[model samples]
Target: MSGSGLSSLAAAMESAVQDAPGVRVQTDVLIRAATAIDHSGPGSPDWRARVAGAIEELVAAGLVECPRTKAGWDRRTLPELPHWVRRSAPPVAAPRMTAKPWHHLLHWVPTVDSERRLSSAERGLLDAVNRWLPAADQVPVVPMRERSWGLLGDDKALEKLRSGRLFVPGRLTLELLRCRSTWPPVQQRVLGAGTWLIVENWSTFESLCTAAEADGFDGRIIFGSGNQVGTRLAALADKGDTPASPVLYFGDIDVGGIRAARLAVTTAQGAGWPAIRPCRPLYELALASPHRLRVQPASADTVSWTTAWIAGELGQQVAMCLTRGEAVRQEAVGLEILGPAPFAALVADV
Candidate 1:
């Protein structure tokens, strides 16, 4: 490694260690800093070796210490580089939140902090909220993006408000401003307490909706529209009058699908909704289909957790298929497999 390259790597490692003293600087961070000075490029064969040599040079110069191992230095690969520590660096001060003039409304605005301060953007948003609150009842409801754009000059600014990243006065909320994304299409066949089937793909959603309409299925049929189900499930919380219902999710048997299902479950649970479960019968039908698509192999943990949701021989089949990098789409179990009375058989057993 060149002098400049070694210096840059040492600086980055020192900065990272000082930022979080006990924390190990990630291998990628060191690699990225080295890449800025090394002309060999990251794709080159000797890039990792060069990086490993530079780390050793830093360690020998007493710039950084490898905490993991004392010897076998020559045999260690770039990834096997010992945890780098720098205790001599000065302690980093905690960041103070920007104080704001809106401290008077601290009770109405739970996010306001005296010890901490708010950013200019947050203060601006709070100012807009204060101005909007008294007139909120009379102001016409508008889409969240539109209101966000009108106030903040950025249409998508309020997107993370519900996630608690941004603060809004209790009196003025996303609902009052109509900031919510359009609710995912839903067909309520059975009004009261019953299973709510959330399907991932459009084709599967249509097939289920058609079957429910034809058979008068005893539940709600929701179109998940892929991963959007994570955010869309919040709509269920708005239905205060309706009794709590069991939610079942059916999606493609792939990494993305599994992630979407997990996200939906978490989002639902966070919103105080019923726990979302895998629709076993639907999954079984999907697995039995002759058609299968080749997909990237999911992690062992993902495969294990997904199979745990489904029981018996079918879960094993799912695990085997995912392990082999094969996926089964929810559309596989269409009207042909679902038949006219799809929910009748699935809802009772689920």
Candidate 2:
């Protein structure tokens, strides 16, 4: 090889070693590249002979050490070039395993037809579920009676699934499993990663999600389950910085509204995520909307997180907002406000 050609080959070899850890040079790869490029470009007619000579010099100079497994042309040794030889080179770390989990990027549900072997990440998740669930051994999934997926927190169920001690009636098909009522054939979601926005009524939730999707909201929207909202926040914080969007809370403008806000903030804080904040424009905007004076019911009642928030004037204002005739939901004006460009900007703002 010409001087420049040899230099180029040396550079390529050094890069491979540095970029890929645990991957020593493979003999076949070097032999192929060496022969393919020999005198093909820039190098002299005897480039193959010349390359062989330079490689030998590199080995002799102690800049490249031959692997013990190789015979004659098994040039699989790492080039102990500059950074490769330098003590100052930052230790090539094992691929950084984000202290935060990467379940968002990984999908590992077992399906009936086939078994796409689980990734290391999925196995780790299964292990954690097994360890945390007290009764993960014999989980029962009867038709959910209560509105919420109340059994989700049951450690036994989680553990059983995690340990492979029990299998779902079907393969755990989707990454997310929603709970719903048998009556209207409704479905409410249970778990998710990435981003989730919560809204009160099912209609608004559906409407907003559609607008979000058309506007590119996609899988980021969720039902108005303050308790689950809390759950999502806790899960998120436990993993890392919550995604860019906050746990948006769109509820009626009343006691329930304040309660919703209170619950959101409380659950996030209780789960050790104080950084999570209540999303805006629900009650605060209801206080000004034309629907502000309409009357509504207070029967839905306060949940644990909301009970503590119904104290001060701010709390009273939230209660007042809820007394509307028709729900003046974010879904109504979302096209004007949360259309693709605006909603994306809002997510960025958070």
Clashes of each: 6, 13
TM-score against truth, every candidate: 0.58, 0.33
Clash pairs detected, candidate 1: 97-116, 97-117, 98-117, 98-118, 99-117, 144-179
The true-structure Cα RMSD of candidate 1 reads 13.6
* Model 2: per-residue Cα lDDT at residue 69: 27
lDDT of 2 at 138: 54
For residues 174-272, could you state the per-residue lDDT of candidate 2 as single tens digits?
122222212221234423354555575576666566555565543365564533454444344445644444555566544445455556666655544
**Candidate 2: Cα lDDT at 105:** 18
Alpha-carbon local distance difference test for all models: 0.63, 0.41
**Taking the tens digit of each residue's C-alpha lDDT, what string does model 1 give over 1-350?**
23544456556554555555354565566666666665565877545444555565555455565554444222332223443444443335434444445433334444443434555556567677666656567767777778888877887666545555353345445675545554554433443356788788888888777777677676777777677776567665555523366688889999888888988877776666777888888887888799989988775446545655554466667766777789888878888877744466865545
Q: After superposition, how far is residue 41 of candidate 1 from its true place, in Å?
A: 48
